[model samples]
Structure formats: C-alpha cells, structure tokens
Target chain A: MSTEVEIKSFIVRNFAPDVPPDQLEPDLNLLDSGVVDSLGLLRLIAWVGERFDIAVEEADISPDNFRSVDAIAAFVADARRNSEVAR
Target chain B: MRWNDDQQALHDAITELGDLLSENRAERDAAAVFPRANWDRVRATGLLGLPFPDRWGGLDQDLLTTMYVLEGLGHSCRDSGLSFSVSTHMVSVGVPLLRFGSAALKERYLPKVCDGSAIGAHAITEPDNGSDIMGMRTTAVRDGDEYVLTGGKTFVSNAPVADLFVVYARTGKAGSPNAITAFLVERDTPGLSVGTPIGKMGLRTSPFSEVSLDGCRVPATNRIGGEGAGFLVLDHVMKWEILCSFIINVGEMQHRLERCVEYATTREQFGQPIGSYQSVSNRIVDMKIAVETSRKWLYDTADKLQRGENVTTDIAIAKLTASEGNVSSALAAVQIFGGYGYTTEYGIEQGLRDAVGGTIYSGTSDVQRQRIARMLGI
Candidate 1:
C-alpha cells in the first residue's frame, strides 16, 4: 500500500477503531478533533519513525506534520528525500 | 525497582545520613543553600551510584531498588530539597547517557556522573512555555562537524551547579514533535552561561536557574541518539523521573503520617488526646490511605513499565496520584498539628511547602489528567 494508505490504516486501527480505514478522512484535523493527544502524538511519531525508517527530529514532532493522513504522507516524502540527499 | 539484602543495607546506610541532613535543614532552607555538606555525605554513602552499572562505578541496581532507597531517603531525611536534588542528579545526565549516549560518551561521562564528581542536569523547559516543550524556541544549526546552539532554558532543576547539561535544541522545523535534539554540553563551553540561582517557594535547597546558549558551538558528535531523538530521550528520562522522584514523595508522606500519629496520641486536648476526636483521627486515617495509595500506584505502574507495556497513561495516573496525594497528606499533617504545624519550628509547615511542588513538577497534575484523558480517547 502507499504511505498515505498505510498511515490512514494506522489511524483507523488506533483511533477510529469502529470505522474502516477508507472511511477515515484524509484531511481530518486529528489534533483539533482530539483524535490524538500529547502522549498519542509521541506514540504516533515513534510509529512513523519505526515504520518509515525516518528518525524523527524533536523539532519535527508538530501537530501540523501529523495533522492528517496527507500531512503524514507529505512528511514521509520530505523525510525520505532528505535522507536520500544525505546519502 | 526491587531490592535484595544488599540494597536493604544500602538503604539503611543512606537513611542514617538523614540525621546529618535534618540537623541544619532549617538553616539551609533559610539560607536557601544547596547543602554541599549533605551532598558530600550522600556521595560518601555511594547512593549516587545506585542505578548505574557496575562497570561505570554504579551499584547496578534496578528501578525499584533505586526507588526503594530513595523512598527511604524521603522517610528519613527532613530536607526535601536535598532528596529532590539527589534524584535530579541521578536521572538528569546518567539516564540519558546510559540509554542514548554512544560508548565513547558513556566511557567519558558515566563514571563522573556515578561518582558525583560531575553534577548533571537537563535543560528543556523554556521561559515562554513550561509543559508545551515542543514549542520551545531554542535552536541548533548544523555547521560541518559542530552545531551552533542559541536559546535560553529556564527552570532547570540543577542548572545552577550542574557540571554538564543534556541540552535540548530544535534541529528540525518548528511544530514537529521530533524536531528537537539532545546535546551533552559542558558547563565551561564558551558562549554558554548559567545564570545565578533563582529562588523558589519549595525545593528551595535545590536551586534552579536559566542557561543561555549564545552561539554555543558543540561538536556534532556531542548529539545524543540520532539528530531528532531528543523527545525519546526526554520521554525516557521523565518516566524514570516520575518513578524515582515521586517515590521519594511517597516516603515523605509516610514519615509525615507517623509523626502526626505520634503527636496526636501524646498531645492531649480537653479531657483526652486529639487522637480521640474523629475529626482529627479521620484525617490521619486519610493520610495513611494516601501514602499507601501513592505507593501502590507507583510500584504497579513501574511493574507495567518494566514489562514493556505502554504506560503512557498509567504513568500519568501514577504521577498524578503520587503528587496530588503528597499535597493532600501534607495539608492534613499541618491541620492535625494545629498551631505547631503552622510554625516552622515544628517543620510541619515545610512538609506542606515541599508537597506543593510535587503537584507542579514532573508534569503538573492537570497535565497528567490531560494525558489520561487523551488515553481515554476523549
């Protein structure tokens, strides 16, 4: 699956337990809606770190980056591009 | 933090220093001194090495053993500031280094930390924000093999006297939780200046201050974990901080309970002792429950954390329970002591003062509740 699909699946799996992954909004404001919290935010970043093989910089742990599935996908793409550049 | 006989002996040995500390506590509290003598006495007992590995001159004890011994310190030592300082000195640098530092970093720094020769502290909270750490303004920019840091950190527990600091600075874009990074910055590093100690209402003996990084240049090799692992490093330290720091609060509550009981039974009022009155007696009963309840949540959550279960919620509850419980128990002690409690001569007032900080530090009770609320998916 694509990064966006996979991330949406994670959101559905962890937060929208009763809803299917495809049903979860790709542009949902996870932070404003209380779908994720500070601790949940940390856990989500950690998951991103592990799943994407991108080490999360503390500065990168912002609500904007992980605001929604599209944002997460964008973050992953940027992180991958940055890592590749470093390589 | 389980303890064997050896740990028990260590606990007893450290507890004896309580008499030494209690002697000049009021004087030190009045002066707001760091109690260097008490610090040396604690160092002599080898208590500083409790949680470190034998290879690094540590006792190689587990989390529970460390908590058990620290709780003993809280029970015996009347100076809450000293206990707070000791816990900070242990977890501030040792924890991050032991967990995230490279072998070279550990080899060079862990021994000094374990020996107490090099005091350790971590810098995270900013003047603009206390709990909203991700919003801190400190920045670290990469420049070849070094990162030039610029920002200020306030309310640092051991910053005034710390020989080294685990400084957290933003290396990535703002609003990104993982954008910050941890760096081990030496006290003597040029452009890094520690402000004079700032006074406080409680934990006064443990001085805090602001640390300024004005174009402070630290080698990139000084970075801890990966470039963005500061949050993980801090999260790990906070878990240990809540477990170890508030466990001491539990000890203080226990000691306060016993002292209140002794005073209640012996100090007669009217035709009988104050203990005879349900109003007075009920308060003591509640204090007992508070102490036990704090202990239960502490160890139970610790056990879960040790088993590798996600205690993000459990720890918040435990921290909230222990911290707020300490304040509740201390207030009761003061009320039970009546006039004596209000007087500094009896030191009962200090108990309340010390307990107040428990609720504020290590993440406020309100913040803990928020964490629990978040875990509840609300």
Candidate 2:
C-alpha cells in the first residue's frame, strides 16, 4: 500500500475502527466526524512520527495537517521525505 | 466546616503560588526536580494539614475545606505531580494515621507531618498486586517483639524521601483479603530499603519507587489496628484518595478550559478567529459543560463527605465524571489551540500527559466503571 493509504489505515483503525475501507477517503475529516479527540491526536502524532521516521514538531501539529486524513498523509509524506529539512 | 476565613487564606496562598508554579512547570518537568521549594512554600501557607486535627497543628478542616484548598492548588500550581504527591500524602498517609494510629503514633508522626518536617507515604501495591489487592505477596511474621516484614512494594509514591510509611503485609492468613495489616514503618529501620525512583511517562516530578522490607523489624505497637485490619483501613481511605484526585483534576479542567478560551479568542484563521467556526466553538462549549458538571459533582461529593453522609456512590460517580470530563476538556483545549497546544512550549501537551495519568492512577477508569456497576447491583 502507498504511504498515504497506510497512514489512513492506521488513523481509521485507531480513531474510527468501524469505518469501512471504501469510506476511508484521503480528505475525510477525522476530528469533525468525532473519530478522535486530543489525546487520540497525540497518540496519532507519536505513531506517525515513529512509523514515518519524521520529527513532527510542535508547530506542525495544526488543523492544517490534521483536520483531514489526506492532509495528515500528505504532511507526513512531506515530513518523511524531507525529515532533515523540517527539523 | 466549609472553607472559612482560614481556608480561604490557604486557598488564595496556594493559587498565588500556582500562578508562579505553572509558569515554571516546563523547566521543572524537564529537569525532574522534586519541587522542594514549592512544597515548602505550600507548607508555609499552612494548608499542608487542612484536614488533620487542630491539636496536631492541623487546620481541623472538613473534606470541603480540603477539596477547596487542593483545587486552588491544582489551578495555581503548574506541577500536577507535586500536587499529586501532596494529595497522596494527605489522603493516603496522614488521614490513615489520624483515623487509626495509636495516640502515641499520632503524637509522634502527625505533628511532624503537619509541619512538613517529614514526608509520609503509603506502600501497598506489591509487584504481584495492582487491581487485585488480595493478591499481595508481602508477609509479616510476628517475631518476639516485632513483626519481620519480607516483600517488595511497587509503585510506592514518596517512597524515596518518606520518613514514615503505612506498609501493608499479610499478617493473619495467606492469600486472604482480610488477613492484611497496616503498619507504620519508619525510614532507616534495619532491612527497609528504597529502590531508585521509577521513570514514568508522566508525573515524573513526583518521585515514586519500590520499597522492600527484607526482615525489616518493627515494634508490634506500630500496627494501625488489630490483626487483619489492613483491607478495612484501605477501604476507608481509598474513597478519600479517589475524591482528592478528582478535585485536583477539576482544577486542571478549569485551567485548561480557560486557556483554550483565551487562545480561541485570539488566534485568527481565514480572516476570523478559528473559534468562530461552529466546530471549534461547539467543542469549547462542550468543554465548559464538562467542566461545570464535573465541578458541581465534586462539590456535592465533598459536601456530603463533610456532612458525614454515606458517599460511596457519590465519590465513585464524581471520580468517573471528573476524570473522563477532564480528558475531554484537555482534548478540546489542545484542538482549540491547534499547533501551539501540541508543543511543549505551550504546556498544553504536558497538561495532556499529566491528565492521561489521572485515568490510570487513584484507580483506573475501568475499575471505576466496575465499582459503579457493582453499586447499581448490575
């Protein structure tokens, strides 16, 4: 699976376990749909950082990236590819 | 009595210190310092013994007073670990001795505890026992003039620096829940050893560790009550411990809620503050509801406890509501603050970690549900 699909799967499994794979669109709003809360978001951040081997900084954890699964995946991809530059 | 003039003074004093403490929390948390100065500052404020007897230099206050002062401390103080340590000291150690200690034990320990000359801890959770108190493996064999204790207690709060500990061990019957006995074991006694503090995910500032008693001998007079009374003593004190923890979290909920509101009103997005969006605004409103309801429940529980009313159900309900609601409030606060909330610089991240431990300590949320279910005859 693509990195985006993998990240999406992880988020869905944790925050929206019942979410069907077909419905796991890239741009689906996780927070808005009540899939996760703040603590869940923290856990997600740690998971993304560990899996992608990126240093997701405090400033990077915003609605811009985490508002939707697509944004989060894209942000993670960018951070992973340019992990050194982001840090 | 409710928080009278003296209690108000104590509350105000701690709140002032809290303001200073919260500002310095990031540094203290990083360093893992025990916050001795802040603790002494609280001692000077005379709130250290708010719930103890007046004769022992305590405030002789009720649970309401204790809750108010502790709440104010939780709001003003930045170090939740330190506040937790103090709460554990008062509820788990001081209260137990006050309620069950022999007059001599009280005269010797209560004054020292009230004066902050000594820190006290309760050691009960063994490596083999977490939720199952009956699974404790510590044994205390009665020798000629003393009980020889042999076993290790894990997750002991304040074990490192405590001068006195209310240690529990099997004294009457093995594997029997009612066969345990509580003893006041002084530090430096032969065979009493404290392990290095356990490095934990949060509450790092409050030092915790294991205490092992290998042939640790203590006079028979140090026992809290008759043989096999330890479980009963723990039962009486755990309710208070649970309640005190809820009160502290209530303060944290208020603190986080206020910070989220302040951040929402300031930070702009798409030509308007992010909080202007219904999603953000509604979450903040939910937080307010949670905070208010949790506080009201805590207050009612405290009042009932102060009035000597049966508060088993009330205490359980309050802990469940406050802990779950505090998590909600912290989550909303972080969301409202966006990226800043997730960073260590903003302290919101730390608050979340500190708050997560609440769901585990005192008693886990799962255990609270079971207690409530059992209470309801489910």
Candidate 3:
C-alpha cells in the first residue's frame, strides 16, 4: 500500500474509527478538527517515527507536519530522504 | 526492583537531610514563607543534580533512582510544600532544557540549575487557560535576534522566587499544538514582572503567583527546540513532573500509613485499643492498599516510558491513582489520628492540604480521566 494510504488506515484504526476511510480525507486538519488531541498526536508521531524508521526529533514535532495523513507521509518521506543523504 | 548500593546510600542521605531541612516547616507553613534554607540543604545533598549528566555537575542518576530518592524525601520530610518546590525546580525548567535546549543554552544555564543556585519554574497556565494549554492568550513575536513576549500567566508555582521561567507563548496557528512555543526568560529581564504570592488553600508555603510579560524581549537563542515546539517540551516535562511529584506523594502516603498504624495500635477507645475496632482498622487497611497500588502504578508506568513505549493511558492512570490515592490516604490519616490530626500543632492536617494540590496540579484528576477516555478512543 502507498505510505499515505497506510497512514490513513492507521489513523482510522487507532484515532478515528467511526469516520469511514473515504470520509476521513487525506488533507483533514486532524488537530484542529479534534480528530487528534495531544495524546493522539504523540501516539501518531511515535507510530510515524517507528514505521518510517526515522527519528522524529523534538524540534521536528510541529502541527503543520502532522496536520493530516498526506502531511505525515510527506514528513516521513523527507525524513527518510534526509537520513539516506546522511548515510 | 532492587536499587544499587549507591542508590540506597543516596536515599538514606536524602532521608537524613529531610530531618534537618523539614524541622521548621510547620513554622514556615504558618507564615507562608518560602524556605531558602531548605533549598540550600537540597543543594548540599547533591540531590539538585540527581537526574542531570555528571559533566554538568550532576550525579547522573537514572529516572528510577531519582524517583526513589524523591520518595524518600516525601516520607522523611514533613514539609510537603518544600518537597513540591524541589520537584518543580528540577522538572519544570531543567527537564525541558535538557531535552530541547540548544548546546549554548545548556552550557550557560544548566550548571546553575544543577547547583540549586538558580530556582526554575515554567509559566504555562494563564488566566484563560488551565487544562486547555493550547488556548493560552500569551503571544511571542520574533523581532530580529530577539522575541517580544507579551502575556500573563497564573498559578505559576515557584514564580515568586524563581530565577528562570520557561515561558510558553503562542507563535503559530491557534488551537494547534505546534502553534505554541517555549521561551526561557530570565527573572531580571525587562518587562517581566512577578506578582506577590497568591494565597492558596494548599501548598501555601510553595508560593505560587502571577507572571506577566509586557513585550518582554528574549534572545532567539533562548528558545528551547524550534519556533513552535512548546507543547512538545511541556508534554515531556509533564510526564516527568507527574511521575516525580506523585511518587513523592506515594512516599508521603506511606509515611501517613505508618503513623496511622502506630496510632491505631496505641490509642485506646472503650476497653481495648482502637485497632480492635473494625471501622478504624479497615480505614488503615485501605490506606495501606492505596499506598501499595500507587507505588505499583508509578513504577510500572515509569518503566514503560523508559522502554520508549506509549504510556499515555498508563501515565494518566498512574497520575490519577497516585494523586487521588494521596488525598484518600491523607484523609484516612487524619481520621486515624482523631483530634490530633485536626490540630495544626500535630501537623496531620497539613497532609490533607498538601495532598489536595496533587489532584489539582499536573493536570487535574478530571483531565487525567479525559486523557484515559481519549486513549480508549472515547
């Protein structure tokens, strides 16, 4: 599955179960819309870091990066690319 | 879990210091005075440096070791307010700086923090926002090399005497966690004002107050982590604060239980000792249960956190259990002590007062339940 699709699946399964896959839009504002509260966001970031094999530094934890599934996937891609460059 | 010889020695030393440091606590509590002498004692015992790196003038103790010593402090120290201040000073500014601060920031500030020469506090809860940390009205605007901070914070513990304040202010979109940012502001900075201590029902000796910043300018270098990482830093700090603070409460509850057990065995009513009465004995038994359960939840949660596991639900449960358990144990102690507990001279009443703040601070018992509910996807 695509990274974004996997992320969306994870969010739906863990955070927003009642919202159907199609209804939970890729660009939905998870934080502001209350789909992801503080604890939910922390869990999501941990999942993203582990799943993507990237270290989500405290500095990298921002709402803009985790605003939606697409944003999280983008962040993961960038982090993976950065780590690859470092390697 | 077994503590090493060094950890046991540290615990015993802190217990010894507690006897000397907490001697005048009742008088200080009566006067609502902040204990500078007690802070000095903490410094002398090297406990102020317990959880920091050894290179930074610390003993480089682990989380569990630090918790163990702090639990000893709670048990041996009669001054709960003083104990609260010590934990606040350690975890509030120190935890964030160690986690998110730049190297330069650490080099300059951490030594003083470790030595207890600098009293540290965090200003986050504002008049408008208590549990809703994201809704703070404080704003920080970047102006060249400095950030201009403007806002007021309330219920700031150690504010009246703190040397450094880790101030949280809005920097990005409202209601978003990333919208907030953390800034390390010095007490000597211009436009920063600390109001006199606000009288509280409990922890009066701790001396919480209002901190107002009117366009206070702080160096950009003073910001911990990035421009919008205040909530993340606070999230980390709160976990440590809750763990350390409630573990101290666990120690206090254990002490209370011990005292109650002693009183039950000695104090007589009717023909036999009060221990003969099921009502009083049952209450003491409940106190024991509360203390043991709180200790279990605390250590188990801390262990999970150390393993890089998600402890959101576990921490909430632990915090709730420890905090509410403290209050229950304190109340039970008072009843077991009978009239002596009610009197200020015996100082059993202070236990109830000190335990009350544990439920309110570090997010209220209600907020903790809300967190658990959220974790359960409710």
What TM-score goes with each of the models? 0.87, 0.78, 0.93
State the displacement of the C-alpha of residue B235, model 3, in Å, after optimal TM-score superposition. Answer: 0.6
TM-score of chain B of each: 0.98, 0.95, 0.99
Per-prediction fnat: 0.10, 0.00, 0.33
Question: Per-residue lDDT of A1-87 in model 3, one digit per residue for the tens?
Answer: 989889999899997889787778898888777787766777777677667766545224565788888888888888878878899
lDDT of 1 by residue, B1-378 (tens): 456798799889988878888897887888888988788888888889899998999999888888889999999999999899899989989988988889999999999999899888889989997888778899999999999999999999988889999999988766555567899999999989999999888888999999999999999888888776677678878989999999999989999999999999999989799999999999999999889988999998877766555567778889988888899898999999998899988888988998898888878889888877766756
lDDT of 3 by residue, B262-322 (tens): 8889888897899889999999899999999999999988887776666767888999999
Sort the predicted structures by lDDT, highest score first.
3, 1, 2
Best model per lDDT: 3
Comparison by lDDT, 1 against 3, better one: 3
DockQ of 3: 0.40
lDDT of 2 by residue, A1-87 (tens): 887778778776666778776678777666545565433543565566657665533312243456577787778767766756756
DockQ of each: 0.13, 0.01, 0.40
